[model samples]
Target: MTKQHIGILALLVIILPSCSYFDFSPDLRFCDDFYVVVEEMPVLIGGMAELQQKVVYPELARERGIEGRVTVQFIVNKLGDPTEVQMVRGIGGGADQEAVRVVKQAKFEPGKQNGKPVCVQYQLSINFRLEN
Candidate 1:
């Protein structure tokens, strides 16, 4: 192909990925079908401290002396609500459930792509430890 044609093709390649052809739909069928990264990732509304305050140490876990981190994966939607929370890593003894509970109750500032709110996959780890 001519240099002019090649140049035009290269320009299209650069522009197409950011175009409406990849439009986001809030009604997407699959929960995993969300952006992993965006121009601005979602932030917890009151930050991690606010979410940590919501955690209730499970009696069984506390009694058993189970202490570790529970990692949760979820999608922060355009509305800044977490959905589809799943445990990525868990230290049993009810810590998994507690982690999920707190995450579901948390709110966030929606992630942005091209200055528009978009769904983004996010991961957070909550630590459980016995206080002296």
Candidate 2:
């Protein structure tokens, strides 16, 4: 067991295990998440009035005087169904949940690119206003 041989063995052990630590994790660095320009934008079937009418204002929100707008972000699939619905901004007292419920029930006209339907990310803001 020479000192040079011992030194070589130590280097080999330290270097070999460390080499496996690296990983090229998948990422969306090159992804075009949203289309800059599309042939059409996703649109709710009936519009705001319909949504307002459909919403069941949270009783707790009305009682506590909690009122505001909830912003939701979702992907409108090629079939015009909302997917990946997420609450971007929320108001308490169940107003946020009510808004989400109504919005999720909505149907949209899918956005198109080059005359073909495409997944489109859309943001919708729903107001929870207490009627006086």
Candidate 3:
């Protein structure tokens, strides 16, 4: 083959791979999904101090003298509201219930990923201490 023809063939070979790699099929569509943002945290009713005061000592914990920390997972909605409360860790008896009660009553400022309000999961730790 002529040197010119050979050079043209070599160029085509190098360019072919890149063309295939960059090709986007006309029938295909790509979409990116994103989450909403929360503007502010929800306000807790009576605040954290009031929540602690309202928390009742678990009867089971009192009976068994159990003392430890319980972790609760919940979601703060866009409106700074909490919901879907569940115990990630339990301290047994009334302690669990007390933790749930306090968490439910506690309000968050809401979390945002972007600029819009979105539901975000949060974890809270409740510690029960036995007084001497």
lDDT to native, each model: 0.90, 0.81, 0.69
lDDT of 3 by residue, 47-97 (tens): 666666766777778788899988887777655666778999987878887
Which numbered prediction scores highest in lDDT against the true structure? 1
Best candidate according to TM-score: 1
Give the clash total for candidate 1: 0
TM-score, prediction 2: 0.71
Relative to the true structure, candidate 1 has a C-alpha RMSD (angstroms) of 9.6
Global local distance difference test of model 1? 0.90
Candidate 1 lDDT, 11-107, residue by residue in tens: 9889987899876445632344579989999999998988998999999999999999999999998888899999999999999999999999998
Order of quality (TM-score): 1, 2, 3
RMSD of each: 9.6, 9.5, 12.6
Worst ten in a row by lDDT for model 1: 24-33
lDDT of 3: 0.69
Query: 1-132, model 2: which lDDT tens digit per residue?
Result: 999999999998888767867644433222235563478988799988998889888999989998888998887777787777888999989888887888889998888888877778888899888878
Among all windows of ten consecutive residues in candidate 3, which has the lowest summed lDDT? 27-36
Clashing pairs in 2: none
Name the candidate, 1 or 3, with the larger TM-score value: 1
Give the residue spans of candidate 1 off by over 4 A. Answer: 1-32
Q: 1 or 2: which has the higher TM-score?
A: 1
